[model samples]
Each structure stands twice: as structure tokens, then as C-alpha cells.
Target chain A: MSRFLSVLLHGFWKDLPPFRLVLGLCPALAVTASANNGLGMGMSVTFVLIFSNLVISLLRNVIPNKVRIASYIVIIATLVVIVEMILQAYFFGLSQQLGIYIPLIVVNCIILGRAEAFASRNTPFLSAVDGLSIGLGFTMSLTVVGSIREMLGAGTWFGMSLASAEFEPFAFMIKAPGAFICLGLLLGLMNAFSHWRGENVIQK
Target chain B: MDLVLLAISAIFVNNILLAQYLGNCPFCGVSKKLSTSLGMGAAVIFVATLASIFTWLVYYYLLEPLGLKYMQTLVFILIIASLVQFVEIFLKKFSKPLYNALGIYLPLITTNCAVMGIALLNIKHEFGFWEMVVFSISSAAGFTLAIILFASIRERLFISHVPSFMKGTAIALVTAGIMSLSFMGFSGMVN
Candidate 1:
């Protein structure tokens, strides 16, 4: 149980991307201006990550070594199509909002990165937990970024009005530039936090 | 003309790299130098335009008529993968200098989101054959422009005083944000 908890915690900070690693920011920045948008995108990605990790873990032995990347892509793309269809059917608006990012998930390095790095080598159960933990970390980062953008860019949270009428939003926060600024600041803050904690641990 | 608008929009207004955030991995990864960025940009122009033509034909002629539209993603990906392989071989044989310049980046073209995004956008907009060709070439040009410009910025950034935490991607993201803001000026120009 302690080992499982350690794995989950490792994903939170040790493997937290955008802040620590900066692996996948294509979808991370483009679709994270609003809370709902971030959550919608993150959950869909979670679905893809979990399913793909499980299947890849199971097929690690059966799949040939020579064409593994190609096989992995096929599996991932299949899941993306399924997720796309399901979103289109049930949540039309969110699907429309996500637009190309949803389909673009097929090429997201995070999913492929995890598949190659963790799942291919780990046991099925471990891979599943890793997916969940990493997915949650991704979701947490997105929500934080999205909330900051939403509050400052549009004076709203998930599109709900948050500020007084007199408050004029900084329109750039909602735009592409704002995505970069927020991400950069968050990364810097995360680094500072880690440094502070590191110093204390060393002293102890 | 609408064709001219499509060209302009792809280049400035709706840049595949900047506005749409497509092909970001290469935009960040291979953009450390200007000359290499230019090379990758040119290769992307060639591949994206060609892929658009091929995917468009495949979608309209083969998939649409055969009622295999649902298989479009699978088929398009296969086409792109094989096309990159062909491009790699052709470049190696004919233009060794260019091939050497591109190096391993050539194979990475298969996964460049801009290529797939443009192909998908062409379908989404239901662009005519000629329009599709124009859009693809122009989009590639836009990608080249943004990437080369970004490379120049990054080259300059190497010598600049960046804070410890914001050394690499942190600074890159900030730069991209500012560029995105600049690109926003082009939005109302087209639509």
C-alpha cells in the first residue's frame, strides 16, 4: 500500500509536467483558458491515457519489437476515435469547443511518452495507477492554469461571472499570449516552491 | 478573391503554428537555430502541401464514394507515415545536403500536428480541390514564417539573462504567448 501511495505521489510532483518536465503543452495551453474547457479536455485525455495504458501493458509481450511504435500509434488512434465519437454524441458543445485538440491528442507526446516509458515496462495494475495519477496531475495543472486565465482574462470562472461589473478584464489572458504568460509564471512558482522545500529537507 | 483570402488567412490571420498551436513540438524542439528552422520549414511546406493533396483526394474520391469516411483518420495517418518514409528516401538520394540538414527531423514530420491539423481543417471547411491546395501551401508558409521567426528569437535568447526557473521552456512559453498576442492583431483583418 505504501508503495502504491508512493507511485501516485511521484506522479504529482516528480512527474508533474508543464511545471517540472514541460513535456506536453500543445493541448495544455490551447484548451485551458476556461475551467470547463480544461476539465473537459483533461477528462477526455484521462480516458485515452487509461485505456491505452491498459491495452499496451497487456500487449507488451504479444507485440513484435520491430513495429512497436506503429502498433502503439494504431492503438492510441483507435481510442482517440472512440473518445471523439462519444464526446460528439453526448457533449456536443464541449466537443465543439475542444475542436482539433481532441483529435490532436493522437500525437500528444504525453500519452505516447507514458506508453513508451512507463506502461511498456510496468505491470498492468501499476500502469493503470500511473495513468490515473499522471492524468490527475495533468488535470490539476490544467485547472489551476485555467482558473487563473479565466479569473484574469474574462473575470469569470468556467464562464460564470466572478468580478464586479466595473472590473475590466485583461483580454490577453484569454488569448494565446495569456496562455504562455500563465504557464510560465506557474512554472516559475512551482520551481520556487520546490527549491524552498528542498532547502528545508537538506537542513533537516 | 477567396483564394487570396485563404492564402493570407493561412499565413497571417490563422497561422497553423501560432494561432492554432499546431506543430508545437517541432516549433519548440527544432527551433533552437534559424537556419535549421528554415530547413525544417521548407520541408514542412513541401510535405504538408503534398499531404493535403493526397489526403484530399483520398477523402473525396476513395473514402467518400466508398462510404469509408469513418476510416479517414486511420487512412490519413497511414498515408502520412508512408509519405514521410518516401520523402526521407527521396531526399537522401537526391539532396544529401538537405537530407543531412533535416537529419532525424524528417521522420518526425509524420507526427507534426500542423500537417494533420491542416488536412483535417481542409475537410472540416469542405474546401474545394484548388482551394485545398492553396490553403495547404499557404498554411505551410505560415508555419515556416512563425518557426523561423521563433528560431531567431530563441537564438537571441541564448545569450540573454533568464531567471533560473524560467531558463528553457518557461521562457519559450512566455515568448510564444507574446507572439500569440501579436498574431491576434491579424484576426479581424480576415473575417
Candidate 2:
């Protein structure tokens, strides 16, 4: 049970995807311009991560050694399509909001990174736990960045218009450059917190 | 005239790294050194051009004809994976100097989304064959340009004193943000 819990917690702070490992930068930056977008993108990645981790864990033995990476890509791509279609079918508006990042998720190093690193080696149950933890961590990072971007850029938190009429929104916060800057600052803050906790010090 | 504009626009206006944000893994990872950046840029240009052209054929001839267009993500990734694998072997065997230059990065481009992104955009925009080739090449040129410029800045950064927490990827990203802001200047230069 402790092992399972560790696998789950591992993704949250220690092995966090965007902030710690910096694995999934593309979507971490792209869809994270708004709080709503951040949550939606994170959830979609979580869904794909859980299922792909499970399937890859199950097929670990049967897949040929040489072709494993290829096999993994195919499996991941198929799952991304399913998630894309489902999102399109039910959440039409979000499908538009997220846009190409959905299909682009297929190439997200985080998904493939986990499949190769954790899922390929561990048991199915453990793999699922790992996937959930990492997905949550990723989701948290995206939301934090998105929320900050939204609040500063648009004077809204999840589109609520929190700021008064006199408040001047920093419009650049939602632009492409703003995404990079917001994420960079947030990442630095996370690192400092971790450092205060006496964890690993960030080098280049 | 429009072709020239499209080429210029893709390279600078919608530049792959700063503007579109694809292939950033390599952008951030390899841009620490100008040499590696040049090598990666060259390799990506080669693979992205060929992969886009080949994937175009596959998409139009194979996938769309059979109504398997939904399988594009899967198919294009598979194609890119194989394409990079083939290029790795071909470069290693034929050109020793070139192989060493692109040694590590060749395999990395397989998963780089920029190559696949360009292929998808080609189909998405429905470029003609010539237009497609030109777009692929120029987009890659754009990628190369961004990465090389980043590498030079990162070289200076290596000597500068950065905040500890913001050291590494954090500072790199912040630097890229500033660069991206600069690139936004080109937004209306063409259209």
C-alpha cells in the first residue's frame, strides 16, 4: 500500500511533469492561457495517460523488444484519437477551445515518457497509479499557470471577472509570449519552494 | 509573390519555436550550445522536409482515399518514427561528418512534434505539392533560425549569474518568452 501511495505521490511534487521534469511543455504552454483551458487539457491528458499506461503494461511481455517504441506510439496515438473524438462529441465547445493540442497530445513526451519509463516496467495496477499521479501533477501545473495567466491577462479567474472595472488587465498575459513567461516564473517559484523543503537543487 | 510571402511568413511570422511552440523540447534542450543547435536545425530541416512530402502523399493517396483520415495522428507518427529511423541509418552510412554533426539529434526528431505538426498543417491547409514542399522547407528554416538564435543567447546566459531556483529550464523558458515577445513584432508584416 505504501508503495502504491508513493507511486501516486511521486508525480505530484517530486516527479512533477512540467515544473520538475519539464516534460510536457507544448500543451503546458499552449492550452494554459485560461483556467478553463488548463483544466480541460489536463483532464484529457490524464485520461489518455491512465488507459495507455494500462494497455502498455498489459502488453509489455508480448511486444517485441526491437519494435516496442513503435508499438507504444501506435497504441498512444489510437487512444488520443478516441479521446479527441469523445471530447468532440460531448464537449463541443472544449473541443474547439483545446484545438490541435488534443491530437498533438499523441506526441507529448510525458505520455510516451511514462510509458517507456514506468508503465513498461511496472505491473498494470502500479502503472495506473503512476499515471494518475503524474496526470494530476500535470493538471495542477497547467491550472496554476492558466489561472495566473487568466487572472493577470483578462482580469478573470475561470472567467468570473474577479477584478473591478478600474482594474487594468495585463493583456499580454494571454498571448503566446505570456504563456512562456508565466510558466517560467511559476516554475521558478515551485523550485524555490522545493529547495526550502530541502529536496534536490535545480541545476541546468 | 504569394508564395514568397508564405515562405517568409512561415519562417519568421509563424516561426516554429517562438511563434507556434512546437518542437520546443529540442529547442530548450539543445539550445545550450550553438553547435548542437546548428546540427539539430539541419537534421530537422532534412527530416521535416522529406517527412512532410512523404506524409503528404500518404495522407492524400492512402488515408483520405480509404476514409481513414481519422487515423492521421497514428499514421503520421508511425511514418515519422520510421522516417527518422531510415534517415539515421542513411546518414550514418553515407556521410561520416554529417552523421557526427547530427549524431544524437537524429533519433530525437522522431518524436519531435514539429515534423508531424507541419505534415498535419499541410493537409489542414491543403497546399499544392510545390507549395507543400516550400512550406515544409521554410518552416524548418524557421525552426533552425529560432534554435540557433536561442543557442547564442543561452551561451551568454551560461556566464551570467541567475537565481538558483530560476537556473536551468526556468530561466531558459523566461528567455524564450522575451524572444517570443520580440517575434510578435512580425505578426502583421505579411498579413
Best lDDT among the predictions, by candidate number: 2
Tens-digit lDDT track of model 1 for A1-204? 897898677667888864664566778788988988888888888888888898999999989888888888898888888888899899999999998788878877888889999889988888888888888888888888888999999999988899999999998888877887788777767766767777321100
Measured by TM-score, how close is model 2 to the native structure?
0.97
Q: What digit string (tens of lDDT, one per residue) describes model 2 on residues B31-135?
A: 999988999999999999999989999999999999998888888888899988988889899998988888789888987888888888898788999999999
User: What's the true lDDT of residue A185 in model 1?
Assistant: 74
Query: Which candidate leads in TM-score?
Result: 2
- lDDT for each candidate structure: 0.84, 0.90
How much does each candidate deviate from the true structure in C-alpha RMSD?
Answer: 2.9, 1.3
Regions of model 1 farther than 4 Å from truth: A1-3, A199-204
Residue A70, model 1: Cα distance from true site in angstroms: 0.6
- Per-residue lDDT over B1-191 for candidate 1, one digit per residue giving the tens place of the 0 to 100 score: 49999899989999988788788888888899998898899889989999999999999999999998877777777778778888889989999897887757777787888898888999999999999999999999999999999999999999998877666776887798788889889999898
- Show what share of the native A-B interface contacts model 1 retains: 0.46
Worst 10 residues of 1 chain A by lDDT: A195-204
